[model samples]
Target: MKLYQLKAKQAFPISKKEAWDFLSDPKNLKVITPDHMGFNILSGADRPMFQGQIIQYVVKPFPGYSTKWVTEITHVKEGEYFVDEQRFGPYTLWHHKHFIKEIEGGVEMEDIIDYKIPFGILGQIAQPIIVKKQLQQIFNYRETKLNELFGKLEGHKNYLELKSI
Candidate 1:
C-alpha cells in the first residue's frame, strides 16, 4: 500500500479560544465542508468534541450518490490540538492530527493527515488525480468557510464565541 500524506496550515484571524471552539464543535464540520460534497452531520454535533467523540457524515464526490465516513476524536489537548482517526470510512487507514498554535495576531491551524486507500494498485493510480483533488477541495472549502465566519476578526488575538456566520 502506498502511504498518502498531506499537511496543511492556515492562519485564522481569530483568538485561539474562538478557533478552538468553532473547530471543536462537531456541527461546524458540515458548515466548513464543501456543500458540493454532500457533507452532513450524522450524529453528536450537539455536544462538544472530546476524546472518543465520533462524528459521522456523508460525502458524494461525484454523481453516483453518497458514502458514509466516520471519524473519532482520539486525542485532544484543550485549546491546543487534537487527533482524529477514521473508525469506519472509505479508506484502509485514515489518521489525522489537527494542531492549533496561538499566533501573535490570531491562530494557526495545521492538519497532518496520513491515509491509504483500498484496492491496492488501482487506488494508487486513481488517487493521483481524484483523491488529491478532493482533498484540496475540502481544505479550500475550509479556508473559505473560515473567512466567511471570522473575516472581520482577522488579526485579533482574542474572541468570545464561535458563532455562525
Candidate 2:
C-alpha cells in the first residue's frame, strides 16, 4: 500500500485567536474552498468544532462526479491544533491535522494530510496526474481566499507540497 502526504503552511497577519476562531468553525470551509468545487456541508456544522463531531459534505471533485464525504473531528486543542479523520469518503484513508501558532507579527497555520487512494496500483498511477494536481489547486484557491479574508503576512511566503511516503 502506498500513502501520500500533503503539507501546507501560511502565515496570516492576524492573531492566533482570530485564526483559531475562523479555522475552528466548520461552516467557514465553503467560504475558503473554490466555488467550482461545489463544496457543501450536508450536516454536523451547526455548532462549534469539537472532538468526535462528525461533519458530512458533498463535493464535486471533478466534472459531473460527486461524492459524499464524512469526517470526524477526532482531536481538538482549543487554539493550538486539531485532527480530522475520514469516516466515509472517496479515499481509502484520510487523516488531516491542522495546527496554529503565534508568530512574530501574526499567526501561522499549517495543514498535514495523510491519505491513501483506492484501487491500489491504478490509484497510484493516477496520483501524480490527477490527485496531486487537484489537491494543489484546492489548496491554492484556499490560500488566495484566505489572503483576501485576512491580509497576508509581509515577507512570508506560503508553501504547499505533496509527496509520497
Candidate 3:
C-alpha cells in the first residue's frame, strides 16, 4: 500500500503553555472539529496526555453511517509534540503527529498525518476522488475553528497547507 502524508500549520496568538494545555487535552478535539463530522470523544476528559493513552471516538465520515475510531497516543514530549496512531479505524494505517513551537509572537501548531486507505485497488481509486477531498475539508474546518478560538497570529497567509509525500 502507498502512504499519503498531509501537513497543516497554523500560528496561534497564544503562549506555548496555553497552546499545549489546550491541544494536549483530547477533550478539546470536539470543540475544534466541525459539527457535521459528528465527532465525539468516548474517553474521559480528565486523563492527562501521556504515552500509550488510548482515545476512542465515533465519526460519520459518510451520510447515515457512523465509524468508531480508536487511537493510541504512542509518543509525547510535553510542550513540544505528540504522536497518535490508529488502533482501529477506517484506514488501514493512520499515524498523526502534532507539533507545537514557540514562535516570535506566539505558538505555532503543526499537524502531520500519514494514512493509507483500505480495499487495495479500490482504495487507490477513491483516494483522489473522495478521501483526499474529505480530509481537506476536515482540516479546513479545523483551521477556521482554531482561528476563531485562539485568534490567528500575525503575518501568516494560509492557515493550513496539504500536500502528498
Candidate 4:
C-alpha cells in the first residue's frame, strides 16, 4: 500500500473565531461539499469539537452506491487546529489535520490529509485514473464554495479585479 498526501490552503476573509465556528462543526461539511458526493452527517454539531468525538456520515464517492464513514476527532486546540482519523471508511488509512491561523487580511485555513487506498496493487493502479482526480475535485469544490460564502481574501484572488478592468 502506498501512502498519499493532499495539502490545501485557503484564506477566508473572516476572523479566526468565525472560521473555527464554521469549519470545526461537522455539519458544515455538507454545506461545503459537492451535492453529487452524497455527503450527509449523522452526528450532532451543537457542541464544540473535542478529542475522541466520533462523527458519522454517508458518502457516495461512486454512482449508485453509498458508504458509511466514521471519523474520530483525535486532537483539538480550540481555535488553532484539529485532527481527525478514519475509524471506518473506504480507505485503508485516513488521517486529516485542519489548521487555522490569523493572517494579514483574514484567517488562513489549511488541510493536510494522508490516505491510502485498500486494494493494494489495483488501488495503486487506479490512483492516477480516479482517486487523485476525485480528491482534487473535492478540494477544488470546497475552495470555490468558500470563496462564494466568505468572499475572496488578499493575495488569493482568482477573478479579474474590477478596479483593474
Tell me, by TM-score, which candidate is best. Answer: 2
| TM-scores for every predicted model | 0.88, 0.99, 0.95, 0.92
* Candidate 2 residue-wise lDDT, 131-154, digit = tens: 999999999999999999999999
Indicate the TM-score of model 1.
0.88
Ranking by lDDT: 2, 3, 4, 1
User: Candidate 4, residues 74-124: lDDT per residue as tens digits?
Assistant: 999999999999999999999999999998889888888888888889998
- Which digits, one per residue and each the tens of the lDDT, describe model 1 over residues 58-128? 87877787889889999999999999999888889999888899876778887888888888889887787
Cα lDDT for residue 93, candidate 4? 90
Candidate 2 TM-score to native:
0.99
Span of 10 residues, lowest total lDDT, candidate 1: 156-165
Better of 1 and 2 by TM-score: 2
Top-lDDT candidate index: 2
Q: Rank the candidates by TM-score, best first.
A: 2, 3, 4, 1
How much does candidate 4 score in TM-score?
A: 0.92
lDDT (Cα atoms) of all candidates against the true structure: 0.79, 0.97, 0.89, 0.86
Candidate 2 segments whose C-alpha is farther than 4 A from its true place = none
Q: Given candidate 1, what's the lDDT at residue 58? A: 81
